[model samples]
Target: MASTSKVALITGGAAGIGYAVAAMLATKGWLVNIVDIDQEKGVVAASIGATFYKADVRDYHSLRNAFDDTMKRHSRLDFVFANAGITDPRNFYEAQTSTLPPEPSLALLDINLKGAVTCTYLAQYYFRLCKQGSQLADFDPTLVIMSSIAGLEVYSPIPLYTAAKHGLVAFARAIATPFKESDGIRVSCICPGPVFTEKRKPSDADRLDMVPMETVCNVVSELISPGGGFGRCLRVLSTGISDV
Candidate 1:
């Protein structure tokens, strides 16, 4: 909790890419706040020297409370990682047996696209406050949105997931310019191809050209750097990163 240390709030930081980023930041002496629905992972966050708050990203109030608590404790916010998201559980195009068509599950959309939007709003509000209180001229706050390769291309297996990811890419690009000009907030999207995370099985690694989590984390680190450009969509592959 040094006065000069930066603070970062990450959604779904209990596991996967979010957890990776949280650990990296904590190691770099950042005051990291992890907001997630998994209470049991609180110990995991502590193990990495990060504070964990149990909350669902889909619940706006709960998520906002997490943000409020972070500001209350740290008195400043520098970065926000809107990384909470889930893949579609079932095929959305599958035929239903009922007389009338059943409603397809929107849980993925709610958590991925809608959750990121909520995080963006809160980040902007808090970032403005940070800028108002700071004296430095280069206080560049950043918000990194997590997207997928499905966002840029057609992933035929899960149409709903693809749609949700596409929305995230579009949303991040749409607000990057205004946010930078008005609040000095750097907004960017990271769309990685077939990442090897907790959600993926061991056998699938043999078939998929999966991108390493470390590579993705490196890209995130670069995007949040003070010199990072705004409104850029980076596509990470097994080989390297490129502009979308």
Candidate 2:
């Protein structure tokens, strides 16, 4: 069926929080574009009104093409959830003693921090285009950045990850206030606690202490409503930081 609704482009929409957001938004009548590097997962997401895109988050040209392709295919883009991220923890303190495979390169930083920022700026470009282009159906655009609680506080043990998350949170806030600079774009960030899932297990500590993914989903869903949460900071934590 031809969709007559606005579209949401979700980076990393093939799994994790990105997938969760894509699913909910699709059911809500938004034509979702799931952007991920995983071809298999991308194919699966295409079955659910989400057009899966294979693009590396760190590459600017790759994402530019992806974003351009989305606009050509969807005709209008309403929201962009910068959700692509790397879930790795081998950095900073282990390179000196490592004798294995070039030591997990600074790829995580490139993908998680730099990638998110670039994707966001790309989204902003489209949002501005929508705001000005008369051919666009959805005049107002939104950006839902997937930051983590680690950004708000020093919760995670991995320094690199925590630093990146902190950067994401600060980026969101910095754009939102005096927010007029963003061409009326509603930029918001969601800081989720350790969400329970099966694709992988959390750290040993995370096993005994975690919250349901649904809890986080509910918050994002609410943020979509008219006058829903935006332009301000909110936190979702099972505890203050150390749940032990």
TM-score of each: 0.95, 0.85
Candidate 2, residues 1-244, lDDT tens digits: the string is 2136878898988987888878888888888888888888876586677888888998788888889988878666788888888776564665365566564577877888899899988987876665564565445567777778788778555878888888988888888754445476777887776777556554633564576677777776766665654565557666532211
How does model 1 fare in lDDT? Answer: 0.90
Where's the lowest-lDDT run of ten residues in candidate 2?
235-244
Best by lDDT: 1
Encode model 1's per-residue lDDT on 1-244: one tens digit a residue. Answer: 3247889999999999999999999999999999999999888899998989999989989999999988888878989999999878897677789999877678888999999999999999988877785775546799999999998999888998899999999999999999989888999999999888877898867755888888999999999887789898999999789988
The CA lDDT at 18 in model 2 is 82
Q: How large is the C-alpha RMSD of every model relative to the true structure? A: 1.6, 4.1
lDDT of each: 0.90, 0.75
